[model samples]
Target: MTTIRMVGFDADDTLWRSEDYFAAAQSTFESIVGAYVGDDARTTERLYAIEKANLAVFGYGVKGMALSMVEAAIEITESRISSSDLQRIVQMAKEMLRHPVDLLPGVREAVEQVAADYPVVLVTKGDLFHQEAKVRDSGLSHLFRRIEIVSEKDVPTYRRLLEEFAIPPEGFVMVGNSLRSDIAPVLELGGWGVHVPYHLTWEHERQADIPADAARRLRSLTHADELPGALRAIAAG
Candidate 1:
C-alpha cells in the first residue's frame, strides 16, 4: 500500500495570491515613472521591458524587485527625476513589503484537512528574510511541520530533503503551482506531485508544457478545495 507520510507544499501562489501585490506595486512604480517621463504609455512599456531584461541579473525577491523599480524609474526618467520622485518610488517599494498576506481560495481549508492526517511542510524558494516573513504572517504557518526556503528547486534539493526527513519518495507528495520548480523535480526524484495551476506564474517559473511522464506521475486539482479529495484518492489507490 502506498502511504503518504509527508506532504510538501509550495508557498507563494500555491497557498495565496502573492503576485497580485507585486503587480499592484509594479503599477504604482510605473505611474511614478510616467509622471516624470511625460509619456505614460512609453514610460510604462520601457519600465516593463527593463524589468523583464533584469530578471536574470536580479532574480526574484522583494529587495531585488525594489532595486529593479528604482533602476526602471531612473531609466525611464532619463536620470532627471527629482529627489522627491525617487523617494516616492522607494516609499512604494516599502509599501509592497507591508502588503497584507492573503490566502488563496480554499487554501486554508485544504491545509487544515491535510494537517489532520499527515505531516505538511512548506518548500519555497526566495530570499530568506522575505520568505520567512511571509510564512510567519500567513497564519497557516503552524500547520506545517517543516519549512524550507531555498534558492532553487532541483532534483538534488528534493533528494537531500527526503533523506534528511527520512521520507521515502513513494511516501511523499509534492503539491505546488509551478510545473517546473515543484512538479518536474519531485517527479524525477520518484515522488508523486499534485499540480494546482495558478492564474499568474512568474515568467521565469513558467514551463512550455507539462511533460507526459511527469503528468502521469501527478494527481492534479483545479483548486485547493479539491486537495483533500485528491489525497484521499491517492491513498485509496
Candidate 2:
C-alpha cells in the first residue's frame, strides 16, 4: 500500500472543545422550553428533528442550531414562548460563536509530528465565518498546508479535496471525531480513517454508517497522543 502523502484533519472536537458547549446550550434551551411544557421528555428529540430537517436549509453550526431552536421553541410551545426566551436562545448562539477554541491535549504536538513528514490539511465544516474564526483562534492554523472550511464532509466533498491535493484515496488518511463526517466518508473512498472520539457528540454525527468491509482502513484512538503512531501504521500497510 502507498504511504500517506497527505493527512486531512477535522477541526471541531478533534482539535478543540466543541460539542459539549452545544450540549450545554441545548440543556439551557430545554430548561427554557421546559418552563412552558413541564418536563416533556421529547423536547430534545423535537429539537433534533427540527435540526435534522433544517440541515440542508441552514447547514451545520451554531447559527443553524439557533434558527432551529427558535423554530422549535415556537413550534413546541405553540407560539406561547415569551420573546425574552426567544432572545435568550439567540444569545446562547452568540455565546457559542464567541466561545474560545480550546485545543485538546497533545493536539498541537500530534499535528506538528505528522506535518513534519506529510502535508497536512485542515478539512472542517460549519458556517464558513465561524469555522474560519475558530481556526484562526485555535492558533494551530499555521501548521496546516491548507485549510478547507466546508459545508459538508461527505463522499463527494472528500473526493474533491483529494483531487485538489493531487493525492489518491489510498494515499490519504482523514483524522477526526465524527464517524459520519470524518471517518465514514474517507473509508468509503478507499482511504484510511482515524477516529479520536470526543466526550460528547451531536446526535446526527453519532449516526455514522461506515461500510463493514472497510474495517481494515479504520483506526480508533482514545486521544490525539496516539495519532502519529496510527498514521505510521496506516502508512506501513
Residue 85 CA displacement from its true place in model 2, Å: 0.8
- In angstroms, the error of model 1 at 125 is 1.9
* Candidate that would win on lDDT: 2
Clashes of 2: 0
Q: Write the per-residue lDDT of candidate 2 for residues 1-237, one digit (tens) a residue.
A: 457889999999999999989999999999999999889558999999999999999999999999999999999998999999999999989989999899999999999999999999999999999999999999999999999988899999999999988999999899999999999999999999999999898989998777779988999999898998988877777
Worst 10 residues of 2 by lDDT: 228-237
RMSD in angstroms between candidate 2 and the native structure over all alpha carbons: 0.9
Clash number for each model: 0, 0
Task: Encode model 1's per-residue lDDT on 1-237: one tens digit a residue.
Answer: 579999999998998777777777777776677776666457656665776677677666776777777887777777887788888877876777777788898899999999999999999987688888899999999999999998778889999999999999988899999988998888887789999998887666787355676666698789999999898888887
Candidate 2 structure lDDT: 0.93
Best by TM-score: 2
C-alpha root-mean-square deviation, each candidate = 2.7, 0.9
CA lDDT of 77 in candidate 2?
92
